[model samples]
Target: MNEQSPLIPTLPQGTPPEDLVPIGAPGGLDAAINPLGAELWFLRDRDGGHLLWNGNPDIWSGRAPILFPIVGRLRDDSYRHDGHVYRLPRHGFARHARFTPGAHDDHHALFRLEDNAETRAAYPFAFALTISYAITGNTLTIGAEVANRGDTPMPFSFGFHPALRWPLPQGGLRAAHHILFDRPEAPDIARLDSNGLLARSEPSPLEGQELRLRDALFEQDALIFPEVNSHAFTYTSPGGPAIRLQTENLPDLGIWTKPDADFICIEPWQGHADADDFSGDIFQKPGVIVLPPGEVWKASMSLTHERSA
Candidate 1:
């Protein structure tokens, strides 16, 4: 790679030339593409660092790069599609796949992932997934599209996991930060057992207090909330501004932070953690989406930061 070389792979002929510009640093595994935030706005790690969705490769973030957060199978890497079982790396392949930039101007670009042989062995269905990211000023709009490519029916689970930097005021700690979901009622927290399985569910109350990130809190895994009223959520600091994330076509939400870590992950999911008593049928899982042949499924989410009045 040279100073003028592109950071990502070269686009195919007839593809939009403007969309193939260098969005990140040269020769680095990951680059800081967007300048709106201090952190690298997207995640495109090393060659194999990306996730594979049904053989459709996608990238993952090692340093705060925007990437797809394919739930259902983030860690330990495996899932049971139909009555048969298959396995792959964590978070699926879509997160690691090198997407061809589409629908580009100066403010926004679209990245896409499609099905392939490697993905068919595990997922066993043809599908087209497109992610369109539009950046207008400080706001980013993320759009997801899933289309069935096979004649037979296909069932799967998917979600988004964008980790945002928690900006605390001077001399403040993460324990002093608060997160508010846009809903009138409380949420049900999905408990994870020692074996990283969904053990049970409980109520979540956001009473305007600080959130303590500890290992014991994740002992039961992530906090999964289903049947939420509002489509947006906010993370605010007592003495500073806040960031708001909104999503539709997402029936579930996950709030997670590394044990005693500095950042918090506000995840919008269409599916959830593995059940302790799964029947090996993908559709039997909660919040699973089943798409017919030639059918297209779409969902979108956005993130914006603003000062609190």
Candidate 2:
């Protein structure tokens, strides 16, 4: 296969000392982003109640982290490509790498992360990733775009890992909250092995379109739906406010939280961890997206909060 020497694009890099970019809408929704990981560290509802998990280090300190290149763990924290093996930590490097902040305003902000020597060493390819956040009314919309600058096809996965407040600050008992999908869901789902690799298909705990939230459901770790049919779901409790999340171009979803943790992560994923029995090329990974050279792949999700009456 022939390859082209494309001109690599450059942008300002994010420096240390971890500063936060604050954005808010006239409607009262507000957010704070840390460019170091392009992570949304805070989000408040229109009524001034927090809707996102506060990264309390004692528990799980991630608010909303972007997952890319690989969604979950590999068989051995590594992958094979072009006869060479490369290593990537869980959820890939995007969550830990710096992203250069770009255009911004009161309610919108854009940040970019491009492949560098560090990235190429781990996953040999030229690519650019941009993440944008915007708030309008009571909704926060997040957009991610990945462009393959190499002449050959680039195989990768992307996902959004957002940990919203468990009881959602709108006033509800933790055990009272549940998830309502847009459609009835299947009874079976995928699970992970003790090693965190994709294990096997098992019976799902969901009952029709609803999944009542509880700590016991997570005793074995994250519940993954590799074949989710709904593009939207609502997180709420009876008579409480709700957070409705909508996804675009994301086919899989995962729900997880540390038992009794104050937050629950609703993840919309384009790909997942490697199956325990499969260890082939990166392109062969399940749910991976192959983007042709010079092409861009995009995915987005929106979160709308409904205030309690």
Candidate 3:
């Protein structure tokens, strides 16, 4: 992947004005990233085929919002920290906060978000979150670093919510697309109740290592896998190019889509939402990572386009 000087790349149609920055591989992938929430707005393949969802307002106006501070939702949209109660909405506020752009070139881009009055009010932590994207060959690598900049330890969660085109750009029926996990999974899947809180764990939905895709699967919302055995999976149809996603330092997975929608979200999460009965301090929440002060926690996920012959 030869690096090129920064230049203005073509923007996809209907792209909103969100200070989006363009980055592309030599002949593989092209992406437009927004500073607001450090979200990825557009992703296209070598032939200019859209590989990402378009953030259509009618269905779901979220292209690829970065989940932070919390992967899912809190019990009452609030948490306890140092005996005081703080409120944070579902998935945290990083998706709605603007990040400062760092060094960026044609093949890579970086954005950083730091603690402020607004964030501290809800999270009560001094921290810095950096998000980076690099495209090489037919693969796009996304990296994130969370640094605890305060005197006390901080507990938080992080996740990636990239919604790829349901049928993909490779050409196949939406129903034909399925996910092939890297290992045989055996644990029951977790579900969300009517309040979006973590509910009971149901039976496994996998047929060995393959999960057949369908609309009815997501009728109740996201299928949360709190204990998954695979670190990678392939989203593909019967033929044509397939999307291969790999994760590092992320333990959970969530597959979600609105019924009859044209996109599917493959989420890799470090933590999950509070359980339906959970009502304790933030540190006691399940799957939450407690970072020591002055330490950094990192996680990454990459997407590779596997072209068909």
Best by lDDT: 3
CA deviation > 4 Å runs, candidate 3: 1-15
Q: What's each prediction's TM-score?
A: 0.74, 0.93, 0.95
Give the per-residue Cα lDDT of candidate 1 at 231.
Answer: 87
Writing each residue's lDDT as its tens digit, candidate 3 over 24-55 gives 97788888889999998878888878888888
Runs in model 2 lying further than 4 Å from the true structure: 1-18
When summed lDDT is taken over every stretch of 10 residues in candidate 1, the lowest stretch is 48-57
Preferred candidate (lDDT higher): 1 or 2: 2
Ranking by TM-score: 3, 2, 1
lDDT ranking from best to worst?
3, 2, 1
Report the C-alpha lDDT of model 2 over 50-134, residue by residue, as the tens digit: 7877777777778899998899999999999999999999999999999999999888999999999999999899999999999
Q: Residue 243: error of model 2 in Å?
A: 0.3
Candidate 2 lDDT trough over 10 residues, lowest sum? 1-10
